[model samples]
Target: MSLAKQLSTLMIAAVLLGLGARVATHSDLPFWGHWEPIKLVAPPISIADDAMAKPDSAFAKSTSAYEVNLAATMVLHMKRNKSNIHFVDAREDTLYKAGHIPGAMNVSFDHIDKDGDKFLALPKDDLIVIYCDGGDCHLSHDLAEFALAQGYGRLAVFTGGWAEWSKETDLIETGSGAK
Candidate 1:
């Protein structure tokens, strides 16, 4: 056979082998789950007409967990010092220590056994903003679902999470749970 034919045959065999391996593997490594675009519910237009306060709205009434954009998270963070809004970092303690939203509390979804009390202590009636490592990270989502099941009425997930927050602003807190 010519060199060109040999090369073609090798390429086809490699492709088939790869396909077979992919089919046999149980883990979804190469492709993460379905690619549903993150749809962030718009933040309240202004403090005066705060949609957050009105739980009767369509989005609010439909789901217990609301997906918020970066702007909403930032606004809540700024007022965290004075307001009832609580920012819960769903990432692990190590990642939480590296950098997290200033004033955010680390209650990792992975370490719920250790941090469940801290999470439970927060006022369920108040808005709890949970976030993790952002894109493709399900820690925040899992935590939010757990919170909702535990009777936390008002919950918001900053879909962008730490990745987006760190990139967009310099407002980061580092240390072992000190902010």
Candidate 2:
């Protein structure tokens, strides 16, 4: 067959197959399913706005200015300043042993309660930067929130966490786990 004719035939066949599947499945259309519209819900109240919200417990990431992490470079800056700040790693001990941000103490979520006294012992006004593996890891968030509950106010989540720190060759450590 001619080149143009062959190309046209191929295109037609693809379209027919697509139509066939749509009809067979009785679906909304290709690439979209069921034709059903998603239900929209009202946005939830911010934790800060809730009257019953415990001031001591919630990290209130969205509500507080100081609770959020400084940028990674700022964290490095803090490290070099000889400031009395704590770096906490919220990932697993095994991961912490493999590699973590330098000077970051391993404080995994699974053992937070066990390590409660250690954290509680720190001065509430001292700066603490909690981190984990980053990018979908919620350990830091949970731990920071928990710490806030325990009256540790000078909290910040190292938002970039270990993932960002690991990329900086000079900022990572190994075999630092207490285990």
Candidate 3:
């Protein structure tokens, strides 16, 4: 076979193998799923529908994720410690045990099937802030999407996650307790 033709055939075989493995494993990923079109601007704000949006809030909305800064996260963490708000750390147990926001719950995306119950128990309308390791972490976003799918009314993503929080605050709790 010619080089071009051989390469094309190899690519086709790889695709077929991938699809076969996906079918065999019964992966959660859909073979054909509806995708939202990419938009240049942020998604429309549904937060204003409820009274959740604050005049001094630093939150920005994108689909199911609401991005917040360190200041907002600190304010939310204060509420979390007072048991008025729920903050979920999407990092794994090991990382969580090493250090985490004092009252935040660790619900890892990798083990969502096991850790998902904590998320399910939360009130749908309650404001939940999810975070992971700062800078390019998607665990928080993944958990937020799952929460949104399960009818969570309000969700926020702390873009400056544990990395930022740990560095900026002294309220770090080591070891997993009752949370």
Query: Which one is best on lDDT?
Result: 1
**TM-score leaderboard ranking:** 3, 1, 2
* lDDT, residue 27, candidate 3: 75
Clashes of 3: 0
lDDT digits (tens) for residues 34-92 of candidate 3: 86532222232333333233512333323455666787677666656443468888999
Model 2, residue 111: distance off in Å is 1.7
- Candidate 3's error at 112, in angstroms? 0.7
Judge candidate 3 at residue 72 and give its lDDT: 67
Candidates ranked by lDDT = 1, 3, 2
lDDT by residue (tens digit), candidate 1, 1-179: 99999999999999998888888985455465667533334343333446544423413422457777787677777766666778999998999999988888999899898888899999876777899999999999889878876777677888889999999999988987542
TM-score of 1: 0.67
* Candidate lDDT values, in order: 0.77, 0.62, 0.74
Candidate 2 lDDT score at position 84: 54
lDDT of 2: 0.62
Error of 1 at 115 (Å): 1.0
TM-score to native of every candidate shown: 0.67, 0.57, 0.70
Residue 32 accuracy (lDDT) in model 2? 55
Q: Which stretches of candidate 2 lie over 4 Å from their true place?
A: 1-77, 177-179
Looking at model 2, the pairs that clash are: 57-149
**Local lDDT at 22 for model 3:** 89
Off by over 4 Å in 1: 1-63
Error of 3 at 128 (Å): 0.7
